[model samples]
Target: MMFTISVPKPGLVRFSHDRTRCLQKFDRTNSVWSMKMEPKFSHNRKIEELSVELPAQPHPPHLESSRDRALQFNRGQPSDKDLDPDDVFEFGGYVAREAMCDEEYWTAAFLRAETHWEDRNRDRYVESHLRKYTDQEFNEIKKRRNVQFGNKCRCIVAMKKDSKDVKRPVLKSMVGTLDLRTRHLVGGETFPEERVKPSNFGSFRMTRSNRYGYIANLCVSKPARRQGVATNMLHFAIKQAKLDELERVYVHVERKNKTAQDLYKKMGFQMIERATPQLEEKQLYLLCLEI
Candidate 1:
């Protein structure tokens, strides 16, 4: 006789049988387990006993909470929101520092670098848009990135004892910084140079907030592509915004970058606005996260 066994989805089993063995032999084999023919059992029954007495598996180790621990013991590294712009440039090298000085140069470098990446606007912008930036302008932007980093207060880089000579690594090429206008006011008001214009390309605009806050520039570097650097920067920005007790934090997303849209969605941001007459074919979305 043959026995058949069936198992359900996603599993395996093994069995052995002698095909040449007749029914008589099969019956004899089956009877061995229940056989009481022997008057005295001299062989050891140790194997059966040992098999049934299997040792229990050990438990996994417990993890301790570091949140309640003091800042001195904190193992967390600083996020982009927590890092200074000076540090970002410090790690980014001379060109990175140069990018901070001149908006045109920075824009040119950004546009050139962006071409290789997954930008929504592939070849739409003419070469003319790539502006040459001045050293003074770069310094201003650098100052702003740092000021915003301080305002956010998300994380700070701790100096290592052994690595004192080692240069600080750049957190990201493009870091989004947030400025909290609650405690103090930012001086020297200037109109946005690149205003959200009505165009085919999607543009981001500042959202209306009852509470006071400022949105920092979105800084992207050349070497940091497809590594979730931008996403982390956004997270750090949001974290800082929340710590400042803001009602909401919002960002403008370009209509074309679906990848960015997906990330923002995953991070719990929703599209709140559509394109208006002034905005044109370029759709504008106001993504907000609650503190």
Candidate 2:
């Protein structure tokens, strides 16, 4: 038998008449080809197969960004779609929302300030303040029918979370607290204008009439102090004031506590020394910030 060979066209492939034979692979330049004989494939042979299809959906840009942020923050933990940055403010320690009836906010409020009172040697002053928080007195106070109007104390609380990886058991407790109330919400006499520094009272545009909110009881635990916790709380308060459409926030700082006064000053707060006619007239300062 003789065989004839010629160049194959682009669409044409040569085939041999012999059965049970197949062309495996071929290189044009070398004309090298290799093949291995195996059982032939029948036209009706059954075979297994697999395939997958994914459905696509369009997502808003903000939703994508929010999901990414949530994934990063939760770090493989479960999270809800409703979590928002504005709802929970945190820095060194987490600052939860306004206080509720759940935890002992009132008790922690007194305990946190005990150290300050002792350091100032104001034991008498501490006793005077404790008179209101007495067990019997607080019990009677809580039973009042008009408890809502009983006193104006708004506390924004901060808490430090316990670490899971620590070898020893950790205690999660209140680490910081702040109190605020609009001047109109509670009646009080503000310091005289002559005592306030003019430079510290820069003006901010007010959507509504200008009002001031009293910021009191701002404190952080010793361990959380000097971290960004205090700063975060102060800034968070200012942001809340802006949301309330208030023009300013006012706080009173004792003259003896120069450290806190300095911290306020660094946050752009102006001072107004008490002008009362007494030996301790200058014992306290009124710090004000224009939101």
For candidate 2, the 10 contiguous residues with the lowest summed lDDT are 47-56
**Per-residue lDDT for 41-96 in model 2, tens only?**
11121111100110111111122333223322111111222234564576653554
Top-TM-score candidate index: 2
lDDT per model vs. reference: 0.32, 0.44
lDDT digits (tens) for residues 1-291 of candidate 1: 111211112212222262211111011111111112233322111100000111111111122334212112112223334334533333322222112112222232232223333233435352223222222333344344332311311221111112335433222222222222221111121111112323322221221233333333333343444445445545555554564446665555566657656766777777655444423434535455656
TM-score of 2: 0.50
Candidate 1 ranges with C-alpha deviation above 4 Å: 1-131, 134-209, 212-216, 273-275
- Judge candidate 2 against the unseen true structure and give its global Cα lDDT, from 0 to 1: 0.44
